[model samples]
Target: MLAPFLIMLREGLEAALIVGIIASYLRQTGRQAWLPAIWVGVFLAIALSLFAGAGLQMASAQFPQKAQELFEAVIALVAVAVLVGMVFWMRRAARSIRAELHASVDAALHGGAATWGLIGMVFLAVAREGLESVFFLLAIFQQSQDGAAPIGAALGVLVAIGAGWGIYAGALRLDLKRFFRWTGIFILFVAAGLFASAIKALHEAGLWNALLDPVYDLSGVLPESSPLGTVLGGLLGYRDAPSLGEFLGWAGFLAVTLPLFLRPSAPMTQAVGQK
Candidate 1:
């Protein structure tokens, strides 16, 4: 639940920011006539995302038990990949996102009578974010056997949308850099858990046998059904008795991935003669 919520919040905020920038730019440039087209694009993108997610869910349900496990494993792996990429990509790109959006807006304005192209661009951009959210939510939902996860995810998204609106309306100011930084770190741990979960799924499907057996049993001492255990499990993929493969997979991912993320990017240097 926590994982899905945070993932959706971050993704939704990103899409909202993009759309807000485009809309603001058009208004400022006296091109507000195109506002309707932009909205049309947003609705289309959202519809497409819903369709794709429903399609995948239905298709997966049609598979046999073993095949479904394999499918879930594959989806989890893909979600991890996409999640990691999104974190790093945003880390590197966030600083310059405004400039990029401005350039895109400028290009759109220059391409006369290509209103549909602008719509397509917005659709593709928002849809990319939406599709990624869909894949990630599916993976998280699979891991969260209990039913609380969906509620958490919905809450996160609703709050994020409110935040986005606040920011746009100048009613709230967010330190986006810090927001992403903290969330990125949190997401890294989530990704590590997903990696472990993926391995467990694959093992369940009989696809991988290495380290197939449990290494230690902690359930008696700290049962996963307990409140603390449940929180830990939801936040960091805690298992009462993890297999050797799962332990190695989680530890290995954290050991390698966390450090690189912790490392600082280039310092934010300003021009010597700047105001």
Candidate 2:
């Protein structure tokens, strides 16, 4: 539940921030006429995301156990890739995102068929985030048995929407850099867990045979079904009797990605996601 909540929170907040930035830019530059089109793009993007998620879920349900495992592995791997890429991309783009966005808006409004161009821009931006969330949520749902995960995710989106509204209205002041930095670290851990889970899934699907032996058995002390174990499993991809491949995948991912993420970068010249 907590895992999905955080995942959605981060993803939803990113979309919200993008929308907020675009909306704020429009208002400042007397392009408020395009505001309604922005909302239209957001709605369409959301509908598409929901449709894609539902289609994938329903389609996966019909697969055989082995096929299902393979599918789950594929989705987990894709989620891990998207999550990692998003973190690094945002890290590198945060400093110039506003300026880039402003430039994009200018380009969109000046292009032929300006309304469609702006809507297309907004749609693409929000859809990227929405689709990313959908994949991440699907991976979470596949691993979880509890209903609270969905509820937590829904709540996270609501909170993120509220925050976005507040920020756009000038009623909220958030340090987006700090927020994303901590959440990016949390997300990397989640991705590492997913990578481990993907390895386990591949083994289950009869794809990978090596590293089948358990590295250690913690089931006697901390069964994966236990409440704490479930939380850890859902959030950090914990397993009681994890295989060598799983352990190595998890540790190796963190080992390589963490330092790269934490490395210092260029200084920001302006406040992020602020009007």
Candidate 3:
């Protein structure tokens, strides 16, 4: 549930920021008439995301048990890859996103049939974010069958919407750099857990048996089904008793990725709508 909550929060905040920025830019430029087109694009993108998620879930349900496990493992790996790419991309691109969006908006406004052009631009942008959210949510849902996860995701989105509104309204000032930096680290750890879980699932599917040795058994102390254990398992991919392969996969990913993610770098300029 924690994993789903954070995933939804990050993805939702990103989409909300994009939409808010577009709306703000249009209003400031006296292009308020274009707002409807952006809404249309956002709604359409959301619909497509939902459709895709449902389709994937239904397809997975029909598979045999072992096949389903394998599929889940594959999805987890894909989610980890996507999450890693997104965290780095967001950090690197934050400084220039506003300018990029404004440039695109300016071109679309000047283009012939501006409404369709604007709609296409927003649709593609929001849809990309939406699709990524759908994949991540699906992966977490497969791993943790906790009933509260969907509610957590919904709450995260609602909070993100409020945050975006406050920021756009000039009533709130977020330290976006710090927020993103910490969340990126949190996501890196979660992705590492996913990587480890994926390996475990593959073994469960009767595919990988090379590292069947038990690393250590903590199930005797804090079983995964215990209250705290469940939360930890759902959020951090905590395994009470992990095999050698799972331990190695988890540790190896964090050892390599965490340092690179936390490395100090030059400060970035704030993203502005125009010069």
lDDT of each: 0.86, 0.91, 0.87
lDDT of 2 by residue, 1-275 (tens): 88888888888889999999999999999989899999999999999999999999999999999999999999999999999999999999888898899999999999989999888999999999999998898997886776799999998999999999999999999999999999999999999998998998899999999987899999999998889988888767788998999999999999999999999996667667966
TM-score, candidate number 2: 0.95
lDDT assessment of candidate 2: 0.91
Candidate 3 — which pairs collide?
A: none
The model with the greatest TM-score is: 2
User: Over the stretch 66-88, how does candidate 1's per-residue lDDT look in tens digits?
Assistant: 99999999999988898889889
Q: Report the lDDT tens digits of candidate 3 across residue range 57-117.
A: 9999999999999999999998999899989988888878999999999999899989999
Q: In candidate 1, residue 5 scores what lDDT?
A: 79
What lDDT score goes with residue 15 in model 3? Answer: 86
lDDT of 2 at 268: 61
